[model samples]
Structure formats: structure tokens, C-alpha cells
Target: NDLRMHFVEHSTPSKKNIPVVLCHGFPHTWFSWHRQLPALSNAGCKVLAPDMRGMGETSVPKDISAYDVDTICRDLTGLLDYLEIDKAVFVGLDFGAFAIYDLALRFPERVIAVIGLENPAAPHNPNKPPLAEYREMGADHFLHINYFCEKVGRADDDLLVRIDEFFPKVFWALSGEGNYFDTFKFPKETHYIDALNDPPSLPWNWLNIEEMQVFIESYRKSGFTGGLNWYRSMDIKWEQRKPYENVSSNIPAYFLGSENDVDLKGFHGDDPISLLRKQFPNLRAVEMVSSAGHLVQLEKSEEVNTALVRFIDDIREEL
Candidate 1:
């Protein structure tokens, strides 16, 4: 479990230590935010972006339970302690966004600010449709929640190929038909076809053929079990944090989803903007990209960068 802590630090030796920790979600490495690192560092923030557990070059833990939010968040907390940082801004996407949510909720004392990409506030169970509805719609990805929560052992043993295959499918599925299968022939990334098609988007930007080869090679060498363990640990995390369901993030926050992105539509629910307003009472701003997909960081780097810089400036003026 100690292995998943890979980090890339960018600091310009500034007087005010605006330490910011960025977290990447599933199917992405620290490479997801490659465009933002230099910009943040130039802006005078000490930035640390890490490939989370089971991700790029990070140590993959053998125990599935280690990847739960509590344990994973502790891994980051321990990472901060190791780096001697008392607190920092937390920026995250997808699963990373979920972890950030948990971080701000479970350890608000340690967070300076939080920004979530794509992930909105926690779901209001009453307004949420039954899981069966999504299943009936033939999107089984969320169904993995049930497997992760209840059928860990069975899923652990059986779903390796499926996960590997479907992982890439999420990218195209979320993008809708216009981009479907088009993401398949992106040069040498043919091998991770399923993954490229799945969650996260465009290997060409963050990962070159060589990089992907390295990842696939490492995966074979390391075995997929450790990475898969993360799925099995979710139920444990829910029980641990069940008492804090009503908690809201007061840290200055931003929620940006791609307006053209279909993948985030369902998750965004009926009123995405209003949902964010309810969840983030102190939410500083909300923006959506009309032409981009779920991979807003990559597709709309300029806007994302502007929004991020603006958020930091707002806080600086407040201070």
C-alpha cells in the first residue's frame, strides 16, 4: 500500500507557500494535470501532483481495503506529513474529486481550499433514482458500486478482463456518438483501446505510446489485483463516513463540467449548477465548457487555467 504515493513537485522558492496538492482519478495519472503544473508553479504555488494508488508509477497495494477513502486519504495525509506541510489546497477530478470531498469533510482543519473537476457535491439519496434504473439503461459502470460495496471477493476474481476492457470504453461512451470509436485509432494507443474508450480521455495528450507501453508493462509485471483492490474497499469507506453525509465543504470551491460532455450529464442530475450551489455554500464559481468533453482539463486548458488562477486570486485578496 505504501507504493501508490508517487508525486511531482513544482516550487519556485516563493515567500508565501501556497502549497497545493492535486489528485487524479481513475484511468489517469498525474499526467492528467500536466498542463496546469507549470502554470501553478509559475503563479507562486508549491504544487504536488501524485499518481494515486494503483495509478502511474505509484506503488500498488496488495490489500484491496487499502484503497478506501479513509485509507487512501490517510496515505495522502501521511504524504503531507512526510513533506512537512500542515495544509494545502486540494484539487481533484473523478475519484480524486471524491477523495478531495472526503479530505475536506474528514479533515477540514487541514484543507486551505478545494476545487473539484466534474464531480459535483455528494448525491442526495432521495432525489436520486434507483440504481435499477441506470442498470436498465444498460450502463453497468455505476453497478460496480454494488460489486465494490457487497460482492468484493467475487468481483475481484472475475472482473479483471472486463475492467481492463471496459476501462477505456468509458471515455467514448461519455463523449456520446459523435466521438465514439474515433478515440480508438489514436496512433499507437490501440492496445489500451478499451481503456481509451473508457473513463478519462485521449492518451495522446498525457500519455505517449512509450508511456502507455510502460504502464501496460508495469501492469503485467505488477498484476491487476492491487489496482482492483481499490474497488473492493468502497463499502468500508461508506460505513466509516456514513455519519458525515450531511457535511458540506466551506472551502472556496469551483465545479466545472463540460457542457458538451454527455458522461457527466447524469451525474450532474437535473440541476447541476443548483446542486453545486447547495453542496458548496461557499462555492466561489461554477463554469461549463460548451465544446469540451469530460476531460475538460485537457480539452479546455486555457479556460480551466484561467478559472483556477482567478479562484486563487480571489482568496489572496480576501486574505
Candidate 2:
């Protein structure tokens, strides 16, 4: 319950530009936004990227329920309150992007705008089948969601047993150049490690050796249970937010993803831009970076930064 979060802040003395909060996805730290920090900061926005609860230097509770979306959103808002900031723009990727959308939906007043990367703004589908149903449907495919939703400690144990071996394979398979869909053809009973490391593609061009080492070392020290807990709370998050089922984010929102993002295409299997437009009435723009993958920010930092800066500037102009 007492989680001391860690964040990297870049603020100008003038305090002239809009403040931007960057949130990273699972198994990633605030360092995921390392490239965007200076770019956004230099472009005049005050940038804050925090390692969400249970990741990086953040101190979090051991209980799984503590990682729910409501708790995570509170953590971000609490950080803002701690800093005495009123409202700010939010930028996020993957699960981080999902949290930003949740915040906007639940507390639109706290967000001036939102720039989401790789994840879309699809509203909760009340009729969507449960995880167990999805698992049965995905039996032929080695769906990580089903695997993670297993007995609490099962997924965490497997990941800890092969943290080094697991992450690299995941990174490679999910990269733009990787054969991501091929893994689905593997047998249902295939172990995640074996499926992840199968005929691996080394030296992922998007991520260099040093970058890979940073993530590997960070997970090695922190372990993967905290991160996995976020996945465990997916169903709970949906259930808890039932009151807000019909709500949609009314704030200015933009989505930037990659054409090669497997999650965008393979997992969701819906046109993100179209669905996002439906979910967010005030959505400003939807962009897809070519030759980029799930880690679009890291793979095409220049383009991503450019789009982000433009979005912030445009939002500022409107205000």
C-alpha cells in the first residue's frame, strides 16, 4: 500500500510548456522513454516518466490486487498531486497506454490531452468472454494471456526460471522484423520458453546489445512477479470499472502505433484507428509508423518524437 515511486523529471526554469507524463508497458521501466525525455523536454514540455509500481525503483505492495488499474491510476494522480501540478498531457505505450486511457475516462479533468502509442482506445466490451473462454478458444495457439492467467505463481515461476532466456526471445519475436505470427502455429502444450526461444533471431536490429542488457539486468534484479501481477488483474480491472462502462474519454487524444505491431494486428485483430475514433470522440489523430513494431518508440524514436512534439504543440495552440 505504501509504494514509493521512482521517476525521471525534466523541467525548464520557465515552466512555459505543457507537462507530459510518459508511461511504459510491462517488463519495462521509465528508461523505455529515455529517448523521448530529452526530445519532449527540449521541445519545451516538462517531461515526467515514472517506473510504475513494482517496476524499477518503485516500492509497491506484494499483493496482486495492488496492481489493478484503479490503483495504478491513483499512483499517477498521486504523483501529480505530490508535485503540485494541476493538469498535464499523458503519453503511454502498451499497458501504460491502457492506464492513460483509464485515467482519462475516469478523471478527465486531470488530463489536458493524451498521446497513446501502440495501444488503441477501445472501450471495455461488457460482453467479451472471460479469460478462461479465451484460453479455450486460443488452445491451438500458445497465447501468453492464457498462460499468464494460470495459477498465480505458475507464470511468474516460469519467467523467473529463465528471465534472461525469456525476455530476449520475447523482444525478438515481437520486433518489426520478427516472424511474430509463426509462434501461434506452435502446439498448444508448447512451453513458453521453448516457443519463445525457438530458432531465435539474434542481434535484434531495433535493440542493440547495451539496450538489451539494461532490460535484462533490470528484470534480473527486480524479478518478473510484480510485472506479471498487472496481467493477473486484467479481469478484476474490467469488473471494477463496470460503473464506467458507457463512459469514453472526452479529452484530446492521439494514437501512434506501428504497422508491424503484433498486438495491434495479431492480438486485437481490429483496426485501431477506426476503433479508437469510435471510443474517443475527441481523438485528434491516428498514425502508424512504417517498419516499426511494438516498441515503436524505441524502434523509430525520431518519428515518434516528432509526432509527439507536434501533438503537444497543437494541443497547446488550441488552449
Best by lDDT: 2
TM-score of each: 0.76, 0.93
Note the clash tally of each candidate. Answer: 13, 0
lDDT of 1 at 165: 52
Worst 10 residues of 2 by lDDT: 197-206
* Candidate-wise lDDT, in order: 0.66, 0.81
The candidate that wins on TM-score is: 2
- Candidate 1, 14-57: lDDT as tens digits: 77858888898755678778889988888878899987887667
lDDT of the structure predicted as candidate 2:
0.81
Tens-digit lDDT string for candidate 2 (75-139): 98998898898889999898898898889887788999988898885444677635655577677
